[model samples]
Target: MFNLSYTKSFMIKQKFTIEVKIIFLILTTVTVVISLLILFFTTKEKELLITLGISPKEIELFINRVSQELILFLGITILVLLIILSILVKKILSPIFKLSLATRTVASGNLDYPIELKTQDEIGEIAKDFTVIERSLKATIRDLRERNKEIELLSKITTKMTTRLNSQEIIGLIIEDLTTELGYDYILVSKLSEDGEYSQDHIFSGDTQMKQAIEDILEEKIENIKAPVSKLPFLPDVSSGKIVIKERLADFIGEVIGESQSDAIQLMLGAKNFVDVPLHIKEKPTYLLLIATSKETITKHDKDILHTFMRAASIGLENALLYEEKTRWADELEKKVEERTKELEEMTAKIAHQEKMVALGTMASRMSHELKNPLAIIRSNVYFLKKKVPMELMKYLDMIGRAEERSNIVVEETMGFVKGVSLKKELANINDCIEEALRSLSHELKKVEVEKEFSEDIPSVLIDVHWIHNLFTNIFINAVQAMEEEGVFHPEGELIGKITIKSCVVNSNIEVSISDTGKGVPQDIKDRIFDPFFGTKIRGTGLGLSISREIIEKHKGSINVFNNESGGATFTVVIPIPE
Candidate 1:
């Protein structure tokens, strides 16, 4: 059958001529019609001439005249028919030719051009079909481009995760990326206990209203759990693999732990409309990735990709946990060994020295306060003297100014060691503090092209305004210094420097994060950033962050540092919302 098919195709290619066949058909029909007309005319003429008894010469002349006229008429009619046929063929084939060219263009991966032929014919129908094909092709290309972008972003995130080696940061990146790219309103990451209890560790990209709602649910559950047996009997068990009522859980876990249930329910509700994947470690449930979206349904392909990511993330998480645990154990063992050695070598001397140091610290605190007022007065006097001093005396005034500033810094550092000293706290807008700090450094910020993204609805917190200002100023100064050291400052070109101030509520506390686009602190030095006298600068007075930490702590707050994923450092401060 195959050989016959091949032979038939070969024969047709060699023997067939479509043009010849069409020409032959036209010629044959024309010849037949002409012959019939000639016969009919001849018969009619013979009958008429015979009836009239016409002479032979006259008949011959009439026949000759009629033959010439018939030849002329046939030639004119054939020429007109051929012209009409040529026009008809051109009209019929023009659209098809355009469509063929369009198809070839599309095949070469150009969908920008469409077949633009409008006719009320079969060709018009083909054009419509081509439009549909073109739309579909464009959509496919767009989807591919979007997917490629997502993959590239994910790759960068993964690389950052590996280098940072911080689990919290990794989860943060995941939540942020998922919410931004996937259009999710809320993302919750939870870990399940061996007995089925769920502990949600992170919630990202949720509005304040949603955060409050989730918090209320958790609080109600927690309060119920804390009630006496007479009020509530059983604790809500989320880990039981069954959805339990939030109110019921209040009975099991104390209000503190029960309130966590509301967060779980919020997650469950989101999971129902979105995607939920369990992160597992060694066949045990370790974490859950909950994505809540406004979308009606998740496509199967999206689910497949999410599931694959979940699997990979689960492995990565388990490995990270193991590494962390091992490191923790090693650290504890080393600490114990150090403690034992210290105790054996200088137990008596250490105790005596500690007591002396405490006494000295107490005296230093008193002396610092006493010296601060005097230093301030001298600093003010030096400023006044700078305006009145002669050119020769100007250098002396500058020296005095430096000495005064140095003394004030020393006093502040001494005061940092003094505990339980509280500043006068007032309700303050965090944005005000941020702006004031930036204003003080406006010249530097303008040079760097500062980018501000402050949350408008951040609630006010009771804080020492001066302390907050100082804290922000110190961080800003450090960032500027880091950028200068790294040569990241671009004057004529686009500025490489960027400072971001963002505030949000986390766990009922106001959290402020200040990020700078500068070379970050090295890992070895990061943890010591808040320690006194840990400066990396040439001037080397590392008391700025130490004093900042002290001020924040005095207001019952906490501050920590982390490297931003995009080549920078971020300092995060969390303080309670004043009652």
Candidate 2:
């Protein structure tokens, strides 16, 4: 049975070249038959001529001549047929030769070169298939390279996350990796509260324009409210507040939870695309991982990778939060355990500082609420004057209106800090906010050449309006102060001082960055600049950044101060928006 099977296999293998063998056999048979026919006809014709009355010698000559003619004709025909067959064979085999060479090249690991075949036959189709194979191989190589890069980046992020003990530092590292390494436009990592609400916790990559815009909007909304001084919007109400889901809620939940829940919230929030995964601890959903891209669809691979990242992030974040909570508990326990003299003094000082802050926050909130109505009135009157008054005075009127708007923002931010009020979350245009903030500071920004780069396609965000406005004003004022200190106000100078404000939506948050070409923040005070009541200038309140932080924290946002590599101080604020 094995012998028979082997024989059948051999026959099947031999069956492939049957057509070539048949053609060769047919050509050989035709050549043999033609040769015989030529010889017989020539001999018969010569004899017939001799029998028909030609002389024997003449017949012999005729026979020889006919034989020679027959031989020459047959030789020429054979040569012509052989030449034609050779040309045909070469034409048929050229593509096969090229394909063989290309295959050899591919086997040697050179995938860039493509084989070119012009024939419209089966060989050409085979060449086409080879080309496709080559392309696929190249594509696969490219994909592998990208994957390697991603893995390298993941490794780096892992190292950084493990080494950095500070939560803010870790978040910054993540954002930096996503922005610089992954080339993400924005990155927002939010902590999901137990109530299924997102708190704006960490933002890494963002531009100045977006941040300024957010700040401006937040300031304006708070200023616009007609509220009593005692009932100011402030911090306790704002911090850890729930982000309202308006549009794209289902998509967000699907991304953070699972696709199985997409239908449940479709009626509440219309969504086209989103990705969400759960961050679990002990099989319980401790956090929800959400990501939103400008892309209309999320690929399965992307979802898988993002899920992996979220798992890693959840572990890190959970560890940090737990550590913080434990530290707090430990400190409390120490206070109770050690009622010694030194401990009492330290506790007294800490209590005094806390009390002072509370009192200050309350007083500032009251003053802010009181100032808002007057600022609004001034703004209204300025607008009225601008419309009713002549164009010559319109510029002046607009400036007055802007100044009033700025004052209103400052006031609202103060009230927000005092009252602990959360911003009324809404979809806000980042570009519009930046434009308005710049416009409000036109008089001041115009003194120093202002440069702006605003991305046209930034997505709107859901955030508190008052806090963002405060954030922008603080940064803008700092820029103005830096320029003033550097004496860049001279009308004639070789070096023109400039400030650049840029905004963009990256990852899932809005970013605003402000950079100035002035004497940078001094290194000695750079670390303490954001602390309350820490100011380098004698006339300055030192509370600008401190208040800014308060407001930002209230909105679950962040503000960072850094010296630009080129020159000057750069302030960047990132705000997370609800999907």
Residues 203-317 of candidate 2: C-alpha lDDT, one tens digit per residue: 2234433233223323432233333322422111212222211234334433433332222223212334333445554445554323333444556665555555555655665
lDDT (Cα atoms) of all candidates against the true structure: 0.68, 0.64
User: Residue 138 of candidate 1: its Cα lDDT?
Assistant: 89
Which 10-residue window of candidate 1 scores lowest in summed lDDT?
Answer: 242-251
* lDDT for each residue of candidate 1 in 468-515, tens digit (9 for 90 to 100): 887887888788878777785356664578778888877778888888
lDDT of 1 at 102: 77
RMSD of 1: 28.1
Query: How many clashes does the backbone of model 1 have?
Result: 10
Q: Candidate 1's C-alpha lDDT?
A: 0.68
Clashing pairs in model 1, backbone N/Cα/C closer than 3 A? 196-239, 218-259, 222-255, 222-258, 222-259, 223-255, 224-250, 225-250, 235-252, 236-249
How many collisions per candidate? 10, 34
